[model samples]
Each structure stands twice: as C-alpha cells, then as structure tokens.
Target: MTCRLPAALALLILPALPAGAQSLEDSAARLAELLRAGRAVISENQALINDPGLGDKGLTPEAFLSQVTAAFLARTGSPAVSEDLPPFQRALAEAQLEAMGQTIAEAQPLINMEGVGFKGFIPAVFARLANERFGELADGRAAVKITAPPELVRNRKARPDDWERAVIEDRFLSAGWTRGEAYAEETGPGFRMLIPEYYSESCLACHGSPAGETDVTGFPKEGKAAGDLGGAISITLRP
Candidate 1:
C-alpha cells in the first residue's frame, strides 16, 4: 500500500510545489511521519517488549521497519520512500530509516534482557536515539526532534529551543490554533517544521492521571487528558 509513483521512468520524481519552499516542507513532514510511524510500532508492542518472560522479543529492527512501513502506508496512503523520489528526498528517507534501525539494533541488549520488565526502551527514548542517529547520518543536512512544553519535558534534550518554544507558546497553545495543524517556515538558512502532537488514551498511561502523581516511568504526571496538546515534532532541513 503506497502512493502512486511517477510512471515515466525517465522523470526524477519530485513533489509538485505550489510555492518555491514546498519541497523542503514536504520532505520535512515525510521524515517526521516516518519517525512517528516507527514510534507507533514501539508503542503498539509495549507489552511484548516489556514482557520479562519473553526473551528475544522478535521485534528486530528489520521486522520493526516492516511494521513501520505498513503503518505508514496505512496512515498516509504512501510508502515511507520510493525509487521515484528525487535523490535528496530519497536520501533523507533512507537515512531516517537507517537511523531507526540502528537505534533498535543498539537496544538489543536492553530489549532482549531476561527477567527485566520495563527496560526503558519507551517510544520517547527510541525517538530521541533515532533522531540523534539521523542527524549524524544526514551530516547536518537535516535533523528531527521531539520537543514539548517546558513543564512537560521529561528530558532536557527534549526541551523546546527558542524557536520551538515560541511556536508552542504562541500557536499550538492558543485557543484559536487549529487542532493538529502543522506550522512551517523558512527561518534563516534552513527550513523548519513544527507539527503539534496530542495526548491519546494510551499516552495517559504515563502522562495522565492525578496531577503530580508518579507514573510507571517514575515521572510525575501532568494530568493531561486525551486531546490535550502533548508536544510537537520539530524538523529542520538545511541546504
């Protein structure tokens, strides 16, 4: 299940842009979507991954990617990447996939450890590691990160930067801000994209409940309910 590809073999597949900056926007959104797709796989298999009785959880990076691919296709009606895309965009997708794979590979020991429940390979941690690897693979060409409001940030690295904070405070949190709408801009020499993420029923397991009560992850819950603004996925693409 993938989007229809350009049929003309000789054509370099580039997304049609109504404006000059749309390619970067599209590429950034694609990378973010793929990253979250991987996170969804991890989220879906939390039980199996955390089962102390089950060694070799069978969710190898390759297997995980296959699931992620299917999830992405189902979510967006597009393949994570295609031979039809132009070299740069294709390279970004490949790097993101490789980054996620490497992250899962590195966590084998923790993921497969016997008698260890809740190995801390949660989706947030997985995304952080994967994004770090993607930055290295992109060699400064692009970067992806998960950031949240200052009070809700559990990890310092996941804390919003100056631009990210502004967007979060001024746009995503505003009463008039459209739910699930993404904000993008060409800021300075790079393109920046900020996609708002909402708290889901599953997210409540760790992020919801009585305010200040500790969750399973040992972090105090923010008492966020479903549909609340949980965070955002920020992407940067440099020329």
Candidate 2:
C-alpha cells in the first residue's frame, strides 16, 4: 500500500544507529528498534493487503514489502557505512538487510496466491517463514534463533538456546518482565545478542491453551496465555 509514515513520525522513527563508536547497549537498542520497526511496518502492510478497499485499490503484499525494503535501505544509509566498522555492527546491519530482502523474496510466492487469498494465514506466519530462512543463512557466520521456554515450543526449532534458556528462566518466566530485554555479550571472538518477545492476543490461536489442539495450519497449540513469555529472538555476530 506504499505505506509512508507522516514526516514527523518518520523523523522520530527512522533514525539509524551510528555505524561506529556507540556503546553496546546503544547499538543493541538501535538494532532492536530497527528490526521491531521493520516488523511493524511489514505487519501493517500485510493488513492493508487484506483490507478490501486497499485490495481493490491494487495494494498487494509483494508491492507493499518492496516499498518497505526500499524505505528501510534509504533510512539506514547502509551504503555509507565504512567497510571497517566493528564486525558485530557491520554484520548486524548486513543481517538486517538480508532479513528484509529475504522477506520480500519469500513472500512473493504467497503474494502470488493472492488470487486464492491468504485466508488460513496470519501475518506472523510470513514473518516466521522469513526469519527461519534467514536463520539458515546465518549459520556459521552469525546466528538467529526464535525460541520459547520448553513448554511453549511446538517444535524443536523453537526450543530455547543456552542464552535464551537462561533469560526466560531467570527473567521473563521467573521475574515477570513483560517488556522485551536486549543485551550483548562476548561470545568467542565476537558477541551474542538477545531480544525477548511476549505473547499477545493474536498468538492465542496457535500458542494458547487446550494444548493438543491444532491451529489454522494444523500445528499443535502450546496452551500459553496472553502476555506469557513467548520467546526471544537471538542473534550472534562473529569476526
């Protein structure tokens, strides 16, 4: 739908973290905010495609994602980032770009199915598909994993990693923090990053109670309640 934020909102929302010379916390927060914002934009665009009025106006998911990718690239000014940037920061930006590109590519097939309509699918499905594909690419060089506590996972891929396991057990699941947390710490020669994700009402159909029930895609439900510590998205960067 060619979603464009108001100029004022754009100014406030699109700031990219400086490519170099920032604290780990600042860098992590910036990356988290950027990724979250990108996700929000994609979700909003998907909704527009489902809007009858917008659909009739020729808004398609592919077109909407393409525009979003372009806007994000422009906002990041990534081309200007020096090749000498810290390995973690550079890889972070690269992964973010790869993620957006993969979303646009992976969504094309689904977008083509617009003729049949996306009746059984939710926006998060597309997001997960894209992230999983990116996770494959991240192996060895960097890492991206989405996982919840063991009880909340429907499959092995969603099982918590060591860092996520600790965070969920010590913080969200135990300490009751509803908000996302971000931190970067040394891992071998580089660092690993983590961001928490909480369950919302939209997640109920798939992850909420009645444990053995199947969701729209027929995947087993996790019987989780709203606001539960659904999972975290973890990333690792290496030199």
Top model number, lDDT: 1
For model 2, the stretches where C-alpha displacement exceeds 4 angstroms are 1-22, 47-91, 119-123, 132-141, 176-179
Candidate 2 global Cα RMSD: 8.6
| lDDT digits (tens) for residues 40-137 of candidate 2 | 66666655444433224233444554555555556665431236655445455555555656665655545445445434435455556655655454
Angstrom error at residue 200, model 1: 1.0
Point out the worst 10-residue segment of candidate 1 by lDDT.
Answer: 5-14
lDDT of 2: 0.57
The clash numbers for all candidates, in the given order, read: 0, 2
RMSD of each: 5.2, 8.6
State each model's CA lDDT, in order: 0.85, 0.57
Off by over 4 Å in 1: 1-19
Q: What TM-score quantifies how close candidate 2 is to the native fold?
A: 0.65
Model 1 per-residue lDDT tens digits across residues 43-94: 9998889999988988898999899989989988988878776556776777
